[model samples]
Target: MTVRSDDTTLEITRVFDAPPARVFAAWLDLGQFQSWIGPEGIDCEVELLEPRVGGRYRLVMNTPERVIPVSGVFRSIEPCRRLVFTWGWEGDAIRQSLITLTFREIGGKTELTLRQEGLGSVESRDGHVRGWNSALNKLDHYLSGGARR
Candidate 1:
């Protein structure tokens, strides 16, 4: 995995031991997505998911001490190739961001690149870096047969 960030944007790249279609499905399928979306020890509940362009999704991440709700609108979807979406915390309008994900097939595996922009600050971008990395690690484990349900 690799990460790059600036004050307003962050990018992370990870290679998964699965095909592009499989990896992409994990994001679009609600049950699959709920299985590996949050950091370790956090449980994610997907409230709504509509996989097409202009669709909307909402999910809540539950930790022992907090409930974090996030919602987004799908801006683009390209099957196993790419996705673009608008993301925001439930009550925070000023911190809205745009996220783009691109998947590349490499030797039967998938390389996923995630880019989030309009973060508003370096601190916010850094927090997302940690959150996304942890989530992606779970995704890796899930795809590798460790956390698959």
Candidate 2:
């Protein structure tokens, strides 16, 4: 309904060594996704990703400690510019929360702005903030090591 309807917002910023095109492809392609993405120290298996507007995908993360599942539906896809999607964890009753990622080029680098909104509560939003911070840091390393589509 409203941005951060629970009155909390999760925003994370990270710059990647790759261009926006390559970074975007890493999110769209399953093989590249499996290679990089997910919380630190967790393994991810993508069940599906349609990669087009209105397409949806489900991914399973099998951590040695626990398993987490997330599904997302693409809302917008502007090549090398922006992407918006609805994301929901498997066991959550509230679904269809939004995540918007914007890619801006600065001095031959891609600056990513990740914002996940509509968290139901302060706890949910806070948890996601920390999680995304970790995840994006990994993305930084992944790209730093020359990861590409």
Candidate 3:
């Protein structure tokens, strides 16, 4: 996996051994999503998940320091291909961002590209870089049939 960040945006690219459909399903399926969507050692709870466009979802991430609630609305969804969503913290609704995921099939594997924009600051973008990289590492392990934490 490779992660890159700029002033207000972050991009991550990862190759998974699973097929595109399986990899894409992991993002929308609550059971699958909760298994691999947060930084290492963080416990995640999916409060609500509505996978269709215009639908909303909420998640609570319990880190060692504190619990963070994140909510989002699905903007677009194309099965096994792409997904776009609006992301924001529950308390700070004004600081909303956009996340786009693209899935491409290569041989029998899948190439996943994640792009998050409008982070508002370099520090925030960097934080996401670390968080996302760690999350993707977990995703890789999960797809490899490793036990979920």
Candidate 4:
């Protein structure tokens, strides 16, 4: 995976050894999402999920030390191609951010690009960078047939 970031935005590009539809499904499918959505050692529970545009979703991520609650509203969804959403922690001081995901087919594999904008600060963006990279790494393992964490 490749990562790029600025004070207010983060972008990640990763290629998965799976078809575009499969990769896209991982994001919208509850079982698949719960199986591989968090960083190593973090357990994630989907509190609610409504994948259609204008729908809402919520998650509770548990780590050894803390519980993080996040929720979002879908802005757009295009099967096997793209998704756009609003993301924010349930009670955080930070403002809500927009995330866009693009999927491209390449030689039977999928190239996924995730872009997050409107982070409140560089520190917030960096934290998301770390979290997302770790989560994506776990996703890679999941796609390669590893057992869920």
Task: Score each candidate by Cα lDDT.
Answer: 0.92, 0.79, 0.92, 0.92
- What lDDT does model 2 reach? 0.79
Worst 10 residues of 4 by lDDT: 86-95
- How many residue pairs in model 2 have overlapping backbones? 0
What shift in Å separates residue 130 of candidate 1 from its native position after superposition?
A: 0.2
| lDDT tens digits, residue span 1-149, model 2 | 01232455677767788889988887888787776667776777788989999999998988788898999889999999999999898988584479999998978888888888888888888778766766676667777774531
Off-target runs (Cα >4 Å) in candidate 1 are none
Deviation in angstroms for 40 in model 1? 1.5
lDDT (tens digit, per residue) of candidate 4 on 17-64: 999999999999988988898777888998888989999999999878
Minimum summed lDDT over a 10-residue window in model 1 is located at 140-149
Model 2 / residue 109 / CA error / Å: 0.1
Candidate 3 wrongly placed segments (more than 4 Å): none
Question: RMSD in angstroms, candidate 4?
Answer: 1.0
In candidate 3 the C-alpha lDDT for residue 102 amounts to: 96
What is the model-wide C-alpha lDDT for candidate 3?
0.92
TM-score of each: 0.96, 0.87, 0.96, 0.96
Give each model's clash number. Answer: 0, 0, 0, 0
